[model samples]
Structure formats: structure tokens, C-alpha cells
Target: MMHPSESCNHRKSLFNTMNRFIGAVNNMDQTVMVPSLLRDVPLDDVGDVKTVTDDTASNGSACFQQDADMYSSYVLLKSIRSVMEWGVLQGDGRGKERVGESEDDDLEKQFHFHLNGLHAVLSKLTRKANTLTNRYKEEIGCGNL
Candidate 1:
């Protein structure tokens, strides 16, 4: 049977970016059977995803309701994937940004650029999902799953 990644010849199927993202999100959902287990657990790289650091506080509190907890991280990752799925359904927001998108621009070039961006972001999200799953296991004191 053919894999779903080959459904669309994405960049000549050199990078199955969408399939990877969907797989990552699905795996995360399956591994994280109990969402409550991830509550209050701090992420490893808090600095990389501090969305909006509090400027009013002297102690420099972080965003996502003060701390970047595992539960929040899970929610954020899922939300992003959801948004991307929705974007696919509604078509890409190319004209909405309007940075340098002229009619003369090479469509293939733009497709490759966005495909590369998706690959990078999806790879990071996949890593974070796997890390969070491992952390959850550790939190529960289980060595192997």
C-alpha cells in the first residue's frame, strides 16, 4: 500500500512535510492519553518559547499564564497543528501577508519556501512532542512504555 505522504508530490515528494506534521500530532495525541498528566511540568527550553515575557514584573515572569507548563505546551502545539490544518482546508494565506508577493513571482519558488518552512516547524514540534511524552513517563516513574 502507498503511504499518504505520496498523495501530493510535495516538492517532488523529497519532503513529506504535511504527512510528518499530521503524524507527529497524531502520535502526541495517542501517547498523551491523559492530558492532565502534563499539567504544571516545566519545559526544558523555556527561553525559546516565551511567547510574550512580562515587562511589568521585576522578576521577569514568562507568558502562557506566567509559566510555560507542559500542559500549555501541549495545547499550544496542538493548536498550531489545528491552525495549519484549517489553513489547508481554507487555502494558503498568500495574499493576506502581501510582503513581496507580486503576480510575477515564481509560484514554484514560493511553494518550495513554504514547504521548507513547514518541514522545519513540524520537525521542531515533533521533537517537542516526543520529549514531552518522555517527560510524562518519567514523571509517572515508568522507565519504559
Candidate 2:
């Protein structure tokens, strides 16, 4: 079992990291505006404000979703890598080599397996994000504005 002090330290670290991420996400909408392709941005009208809001909300939500998904995938991959690295360091990586279970040999196979799964998820997310981006571009409604 983890000592009380160790547990408290771990919790504090997690909370700090989480707070930073939350702060960034909360301000993302204002930071991300229309693309530079539209140089004639009109901020003088209420209509423009409405359009910007709609576009920003959609795009920001899509971005946050993609970021969250990718972060989760990255976390999973890193966790697996850390475990494998630790096992290698301990010289007990091979669960049962004589039984044809070579750790080094299977490492690549397992890594690829996990990587392929992550790739599939990221691919889907990219497609979705691209769609959202395209929609935002369309909302800009400026073929040459």
C-alpha cells in the first residue's frame, strides 16, 4: 500500500495537472477564431458576432473532443510502454520464453497491436475534426473575401 504522504503527493500532482489543462480548455474558444484566409473580418456588426459565435462553438467543441480522445490514447500507450520498460529493467520481461513466449520478440507484436488500435481511433477522430473544420470554413462564407 502507498504511504499516506505518497498518496497525497500523487493526488496533488494530478490535481495541478488537471487544473492547468482545464484552464487551457476553458480559454480555447476565445483564442481560436476564424481562419486568416478571410482577411475582411467585420467585427462592427452584430451579425458578424453571431456568426463568429456559432462557428467558434462548433469548432472549439470539435477540437476539445479530438484533444481529449488523443490524450486518452496517448496516456494508454505511455502506460503500456512504462510497464514494458519496467519489466525489461527487472530482467523478467519474458513471461515464458521456453514456452515460446519471448518478451523481446513479443514486445514489437504487442506494441503494434496497441498502436494499430490507437491509430484506428485517431483516424476516426481526425476525420470528424476535418469535417468540423470544413464546416467552419464554409461558415466563413468567403470564396475570396
Candidate 3:
């Protein structure tokens, strides 16, 4: 019962929605997504999640998490390097003198690194979710809703 123009528009909209979804999925980051994605399941079950989600790669947070992790890792590395370099500049020590450097330094570094990574990963996931949700909204059509 729909007009030809209306039908064509509907098809175009559907195609756009699908293309956008695939693009979003293909562009996700994986490294950062692994941990949190594993959170809800048993350690042994992680493999299952991976297997199940593998086909629908965009259905989970892997890609976004990875991108986030990379960005966070880069930032954390930069920050640590900066703090170390700056501390050296400010102090009268030589050969990468320890500032905030201790037995727990490595642990602290990792903790902050992961935390920052998590934050970034979550942010990216959120953005992707928002985008996909918007696409769904658009596909459903405002007038229909």
C-alpha cells in the first residue's frame, strides 16, 4: 500500500542503518574490551563469550575497549614519561632519579593505566552505543514511533 517513493526511502534507510552498524562494529577496539567483557562471566566462560560474540563482533565492547585501551596506554605512558622527565628536571639527581618511584610504583602504574584505559574504553563504548541506538531510532522512524 505504500507509494513507490516511500518504499524506496524505506529501503534506503534500512541500507544506511545496516551499513552504519557494520562500520561501527568493524572499527571497534578489542584489547580494552576483553577484561570488562569478561567481568560478568566465570574465567573459564570467557572463551565462550568470545566464541559467541565473535560472529557479531559489534555486539560487544571489544573494539571500543581496545581503542580506549590504546589511547589510555598511550596517555599513561606519556604521563609516566613526563612525570619522570619533569621530576628529573626539577631535582638535582642524575640517571632517571626515582620520583613516585618505589616498589609499588609498578603496581600503581598498572592500576592507573588500567583505570584510565577502562575510562576511555567505556567512553568509546558509550559513544558507539549512542550512535547505534540513534541509528535504530532513525530506522524505526520518528513518525512511526
Candidate 4:
């Protein structure tokens, strides 16, 4: 059992760590945009303003959907990583000796399992993006510009 001051300090530390994690997640959300390849679709002149045809609009929507899916998956992976990191940090504290050694081992195993799964998903997303980019290049008869 923790003394009153020790419990208070522990809570404070946890709060600070949570704040940092939330800030990191928010920063990632703000900075990560859809790949430029997805956003480089050309627009056609329609009256004074540029516009996309129905087919082009549909394609653009599909690209946006793919981008959203990738981004969400990436965010999920990051969140998991952040939580695992926080767990490691906490384990480094007095809690490590208090918490059974087996618990730490189990946590480490879970972290690795989730990390590997997320990496696989991220790899597939990268491959899909690359395939789309190559197809676009072939259709346009020009390399990525």
C-alpha cells in the first residue's frame, strides 16, 4: 500500500504522462496529411473556376477514402506505441519491482505482437499507395512530378 504522499505523486506522474501522450497524438493528427500523390489530381476548367468531372470526382473521393483509412490505421498504431512506451516508463519507476516480473514480461510480449501487426498493415498500405502511383504514372505518360 502506498502512503498518501506517494499515491498523490503517482497520480501526478500519470496525469503528466497522459497529457504528453494526448499532445503527441494531437500533433500527429495536425501534421500528417494525405500523400501528395493522392492530392495531385488535375482539375478541368469549367466556366471561371476549375472543377472535376463526375468520374474524376468519384476517383478523388475513392482516393480520399483510402487516405482516411491509412491515416486512421497509422494513428491507431501510434497510439498503441505511445501506450507501450508509457508502460515502459512506468515500469522503470518503483512500480516495476512492485508489479510482478511476469507482468512486465507479458506486457513486453503484447507490445511486440501489436507492433508487428501494425507494421504489416502499414506495409500493405504503402504498397497500395505505390501501386496507385505507378498506375497514375502509366496513364499520364509521365513520372511523378
Candidate 5:
């Protein structure tokens, strides 16, 4: 029942939002450095508690956390993309007719294809996160004793 222009505008807004989300994620990716918790520790410490001098362990933990955040963002974007695709598919027939059946079908196919690609990327990211976590565990375990 929605007007064609309104539907178009809605889709455009969704696309804009998606772009913004991706941009934010990319920006975060570029600056994904883990801060050292030991930096705040005072040098005047009294007892036998040693300072964490190993930067690798802190950096590894930070990288794992960043990967986890990226994975979460990707999952959210995938859900949003799915909803947008559904909206496009369920739009009034008038818009579909105006856009031409073949064109609409092609657009849908492309959207699905891109979505599948996103899924694959997410899968790879998940595997990388798992590897990072395992590495972190090993490092921590070794460093503790």
C-alpha cells in the first residue's frame, strides 16, 4: 500500500545507514590497538606484585577483543541487510512494475549474492577469532607460571 517513492526513499535510507555502519567498522579496524592496562599502574608499588612488561600478551588480548567487536558488527549488518532485502521483495507490485520485472529480479539476485559473500567473510572472521583466542590462552598459560 505504500507509495513507490516512499518505498524508494526507505530503501535509500537503509542503504545510507548500511554505508555509515560499514564506514564506522572500517575506521575502527584501522585504529584497533589494544591499550596496556599496566600503563596506569604506579611505579611506587610496595610489595611483590610485578609489573606486566610483556607487551605481546596485552596486544594479543586487545586484538582478540577487536576481532570479537568486528564479528558482532558484521552479524548486526547481516541482519539489517536481510530486513532490507525482505522489504524490497515485499514492496507493492506497482513499484516492481515500474522498475521492470527483469530489473527487480536482477537486483534481488545481486543482493542475495552479496549477502552470501558477507556470510562467507563472517565465517572466516569467526575462525580467525577462534585462532586468536587459542593463542591468547596459550600465551597467558605460559606467562603465568
Candidate 6:
């Protein structure tokens, strides 16, 4: 039988965070019908991938200039979801890199730090996806999201 601790660990794994991100992206894809409206619409932090990904109410409207657009964000979201499923180095790099015992402490600290960042990014992406869907609905004159 699987240990309870192991089960709990699995829930907190990066895979879990990735799964949630995928779901949000999938929903965004389905909700967006006229994607042309999303084109050239500024968005993100990275040049081609820049925009706001906050989980709270965003100031992202079609009014101001930004980095990426909703369309690009949508595409990026889907691409990331694909990568999580297919994984990095899908064909190779399956072997593990063992860390020295002396580095274990640093590794643990780094892992937690990166994990927290991952959680924050995922939350932002999920919120962005939902926001895009809601915006599209509003454009189409749909009921309250």
C-alpha cells in the first residue's frame, strides 16, 4: 500500500501545479471563439511573453500598450501545458543527477524557493486564463462569468 506521507507529497508536487495550469489553459482555449480579437493585444513580463498574470483583479484592458497579447498568452499557456506533459528532453536526459550530501541543505533550500516561485507563476497563469475567458464572454455579450 502507498504510504500516507508519499500521497501527501505527490499532491504538493510540481506535477500537481502543472495539472492545474493545463486545466485553466484548456478552459481558455474552449471559451475563446474569435481569437482575432485577442491578437496584438498587449500582455506579459517577457518581451514576446510579457503581461500581467495576477490572480487578483487586473488592469489589463485593450486600452494600453503591453508586451504580449491575450492570443499570445493563450498560445503560450497551451505550449507550456504541452511541455509539462511531454516533459523537457522528452527523448533523453532521463538519468538523475545526484547531489553530494554536503549540498543537500542548499539543494533543499533552493528547491523550496523555486517551488514557491512555481506556485506563484502558476496561480498567475491560471488567473490570466480565467480573465481572458471572462473578457471574451463580455465581448460576446454573454451572461455573467
Best by TM-score: 1
Worst 10 residues of 4 by lDDT: 43-52
Clashing pairs in 1: none
lDDT of 1: 0.66
Can you tell me which runs of candidate 2 are displaced by over 4 Å? 1-105, 143-145
Compare candidates 4 and 6 on TM-score and give the better one. 6
The list of candidate 3 runs beyond 4 A from truth reads: 1-105, 143-145
- Candidate 4 residue-wise lDDT, 80-116, digit = tens: 4455456533322323344445655679888778666
| Tens digit per residue, CA lDDT, model 6, 61-128 | 22112555667667666766676777655333343556655555688888889898988777777777
Tens digits of per-residue lDDT for model 3, 12-78: 4534444443344433332223323323222221222112233223433232222232333222323
Tens-place lDDT digits, model 2, residues 50-111 = 12233324533222222233232223323333443354333333443467565777788888
Could you give me the TM-score of model 1 versus the true structure? Answer: 0.63
- Candidate 6 RMSD to the correct structure: 8.7
TM-score of each: 0.63, 0.28, 0.29, 0.29, 0.30, 0.61
What pairs collide in candidate 5? none
What's the lDDT for residue 119 in model 5?
53
Q: What is the lDDT of candidate 4?
A: 0.43
Q: Estimate, for each residue in 68-93, the C-alpha lDDT of model 5 and write its tens digit.
A: 33333333334433444455343323
Q: Rank the candidates by lDDT, best first.
A: 6, 1, 4, 5, 2, 3
lDDT of each: 0.66, 0.39, 0.39, 0.43, 0.41, 0.67
Off by over 4 Å in 5: 1-105, 142-145
Model 6 residue 137 distance off true place after TM-score fit, in angstroms: 1.3
Model 4 residue 101 lDDT?
54
**Candidate 4 ranges beyond 4 A from true positions:** 1-105, 143-145
lDDT of 1 by residue, 1-145 (tens): 6676755555344246656766777777777878998887888766565354433123332224446799987786686677567753333333355567685679899888977776776677677777777787788787398
